[model samples]
Target: MKTAMLEREGFAALVLRLRAEGISDLDLLTAVEQTPRSRFVAPHLAEHAYSSRTIPIECGAFMEGADLAVRLIERLRVKPGHRVLEVGTGSGFMTAVLGRLSERVVSIERYRTLVTDAQARLDSFGLRNVILRHGDGAGGLPGEGTFDRIIVTAAFPAMPRAFTEQLVHNGVLLAPIMIDEDRCIMVRLTRTGSRFEREDLFEVPYLPLTPRVAAFL
Candidate 1:
């Protein structure tokens, strides 16, 4: 069994590496340190959970890398008392992070198994600020009302109208825009009242987010 001291040291080392890579968000770094990535992945793959590599779960979609997740969360500019809409709940690692940073998080997932497992993990961590759902994220959660921040974890072929329309004024959206069959670019769009300004942040490869619900066996 890995001792708590060893776990703390490991997390410390990972934070140091992230800091070296120019990640200067103290709150984000602190959240990463507090949340154990091992809790989100299987035991055999726990050793690689903190690394900047995508970890596959039971669902067909893969979890975002630690580096990418940090970058996106930093760009999200989460603040206390802010309601966030997270489009992919995957392993709930990011959801847990969002729970720490925002007032509340509404996360939607297409796969029932991922939702169930991620919900259990989030609940086990005592993060009651998050609401997990099994649904098509492209539709957004209209019943939950507008969000102060929106994050999409997978690549979408076209800009989602629901996401843009559901954003509160001055809200920000960080998502991967699918440019082609194999290419995607990360974009940060901010809604300013009736208009939205788009900025291309970086390039990333992500699993395509579909509108159809998954048929979990």
Candidate 2:
């Protein structure tokens, strides 16, 4: 009982920090608060579930910090009716949050282990709106039809043309673009007619987006 209380208190403190960082959307905050982040991470790393830093997960992937994930989702401007495509569903933590914010979420992960684990966690939460698949997310899922929003968790050398083409009119795509060997900037691209209006949001630290799905692991 004492441990549970401490966990709750820690999470509450994390929520406070997020609010201070300008995450004022009531619904977004509620989703983040309600989702059990600890369940999405490895048992040994549960204590750092609410921390504002990345945690290593299965298949050698890292889950983005809670603060960064929420900020990027905020920039996407997810709506209750929006269909979101999430590339790199590391822990399915963000997938669950996106499920709460949007109508439907199709999340793809490169590693089969990550996909299986994430699907189980999402299912436990009864998030039926999310679909988890094991595939290369480098080029967004174009065959799934157009989406209202697309968020890439990994950093790419350039804006992926396939992702931009998979967005519906006026749809938003948020991704980290590598400006150089060590510099990465998060960019928001909005589809307008036949062109995309790009807005550089902020710098971020993310692993490079790789091609092809993992055959082993």
Best by the TM-score measure: 2
Instruction: Kindly list the per-residue Cα lDDT of model 1 for residues 1-217, writing each as its tens digit.
Output: 5845545766777778777878878888888877888888887877777777888888667777777787789899999999999998888999999999999999998899999999899878899999998888877888778999999988888777888988999999888889889999988999998999999988886768777678762
Candidate 1: pairs in clash: none
| Candidate 2 lDDT, 1-217, residue by residue in tens | 7546646976788778877888788898888877878888777877787788899988889988777878888899999999999999988999999999999999998999999999999888899999998998888996779999999988999998999899999999999999999889999999999988999999988878888999897
The number of the candidate with the highest lDDT is 2
Per-model C-alpha lDDT, please? 0.85, 0.88
For candidate 2, list the clashing residue pairs, or say none: none
Model 2 segments more than 4 A misplaced = none
Candidates in order, TM-scores: namely 0.94, 0.95
Q: Lowest summed-lDDT stretch of 10 residues in model 2?
A: 1-10
Candidate 1 residues lying further than 4 Å off, grouped into runs, are: 1-6
Model 2 error, position 177 (Å): 0.6
lDDT of 2: 0.88
